[model samples]
Target: MSVRRWWWVAALGLAVTGCRTTGSAARDGQGTPPKQELQFDPVTVTADLELDKLNDEELFAGGTSAFAANDFKQAARYFGRLADFHPDSRHRRAALYNAGLSHQRLKEWEEAEHRFSELADPEKGQGDALDAAFRVAESRYHLERYDEAVKLLGTIAAREDLPVNRRLEAQVQQGVCQLEAGRGEEAEKTLRKSLATYEALADKDEVDDYFPAQAHFFVGEIYRLHYEGVKLDPAKGSDKLAEDLNYKAELLLSAQGHYLRSIRVGNGYWATAAGAQIGALYENLYEHMVNSPAPAELNAEEAQVYRQELRKKIRVLITKSINIYERTLETAERIGSQSAFVDRTRASLEKMKALLLADAEGEPAPDPAAADGEPHS
Candidate 1:
């Protein structure tokens, strides 16, 4: 069935089922039973009245059920109806929030953006409004509207009214958007700010340790990407490019450190992700060492020293990659209990080991095929 049609059917079902009303059986009184009456607590009576009068609770419940059923459009409609019918109901704000989520699930980007935008306005809904604004930015980000996402996230990051953790998340997401937009320098700056923010929070013990680990991982990814960019560009071979190469190396090493830190403090999904990133970084570094050009201005002794340093770095990275893969394999085995991913990890580790052995046995040199008469310039 078409998703839209299925959604409508689900909505009709929920609407019918949720509003079914029940009543107590009538009492059969003989002659004068002393006029006994049932009494309800004030709070309970008020709650029941609110439930019956507003119907907001039922609406939200129906929306949640529809969402669980993967009927996102129905969920949106249910929540949207609550927001429309009970504009002043206490649950109006929550209804709007869930409506936005439903739109997100349905991939209705513009509708999600609109719902989030409405909730984000402080004058419109003061309590959870800031959180809604952040979600708005996040929605824009997933839509690949980088510039708009960056602007919205930057505003949220700058707001003193927002919680520190949310500010940090905003900053990290902003950095990610910047990186995606190919503004590496700006991305580096934003990521550094995020890391510093997390570090400060860590020092105070005010932030969850997970936030710091996430910041570290994100910063590491930024650095790793920067390193890969230089490695991929053939034009970056000038003497002036030496600084870029050194910077790349420094960043990769820094990223390796952070990834390792994340692995140490992380578990479950974060641990797996950090381990994979660490292994990938090491693999990339190893590839760079394998492909690096020989120094153009090195004497015999200097050349020997350079080659030795390069080999040492390569060795370290290979060992690191192996260890990361081992950790990933163990984690996957624990989680999935002999899944296909675990088997793939094992196979990859075996291949990496063979490659490491071959690299160790062979002498390092520029590929003969790359020795064509033409210069890179």
Candidate 2:
């Protein structure tokens, strides 16, 4: 469930950078010729070595070195020089891609997108344009251009020669873009296919096998949104209540099932999130029950019996909810998750505890939000 928001950070864990100190600029007779103000975006490259001695390959090496060191501005400058000045250089296409990557690392999405667009062009781009297409989609996704992201991802997914892993990643990203764009049914269809591909993989334990859990989590979110739209009215007779409750139960259970599947497939942050959400799901149902009015047709005795039954159900539901919250806490702790989510789960657990105690004491629980000084949802 570690959904990748962008490809910029993807290389951070895979490659460790070496230390490289920025060299002090040497003063010249004209004082560095009064820094040139260029018409295009600024791309300044500096080095301790003589500029004249550095060839395109050396410039590219400097860019990649700076990239490894996380100096995105410096990296972009070096790569940009190769892309802008060395048009005939064999490294031009790669330089463009690296420039895009450097800008991406700096969170300069527009600049990154521009560079990536050049690489995405079949006629002009060289070497692995398909991968460049994926990066272009990633840039668009981060910029909240969900429609563009989906279209680009579709192109990558449709390629016959693309690796299955890359294709699946593209499909998953396409589904994510759909979901973000509020196209739930389309998201579900695409994500379901991605999930099936993950499940069908011969090596389920592959390091890159992340889409299955993410797909499950997103599908559960779709169900959760739909469930929130359902309203149950207690003014309706018990028969009506029974029918409506059954329907609500189906929606909630569907969400719960997918959440559990996410947890089962991957015991990562997404699983913890799904676990926390399951607790919230049950608590929401309990709240609905507590807030509901008695049926108008019930006799006094029948109303009393119904009230008792309601209280029992509420307590049972909340208790189940509390247990799931506790499970989330335990899982987070077990995984040494120091994420803010772990703190939120802890706060939610405390709130659930108060809720359970409130029912036992026959008094309203202190506002769970007040107890934690943090909003639950």
Best of the candidates, TM-score: 2
Tens digit of lDDT per residue, candidate 2, span 1-377? 11112122111112223333443555579666443332444344433333336778887777777777777766766677677667899977778777777678787888888887876842233344765777788889889999988987877777667567777878888999999999999999999998888878888765254667778888998999888888888778888987888888789989988988888876577878888888889889988889998888999999999998888777777777777888888888888766676677788778878878877799454344333321122
Query: Where does candidate 1 have its weakest 10-residue lDDT segment?
Result: 2-11
| Model 1 lDDT per residue over 188-250, tens place | 789788777766663545555565566667767776776677753334444644676677768
What TM-score, over all chains together, does every model reach?
A: 0.62, 0.70
lDDT of 1 at 245: 62
> Residue 159, candidate 1: how far off, in angstroms?
2.8
Would you list the C-alpha lDDT of every candidate in the order shown?
Answer: 0.65, 0.74
**Cα-lDDT of candidate 2:** 0.74
After superposition of all CA atoms, the RMSD between model 2 and the true structure is: 11.2
How much does candidate 1 score in TM-score?
0.62
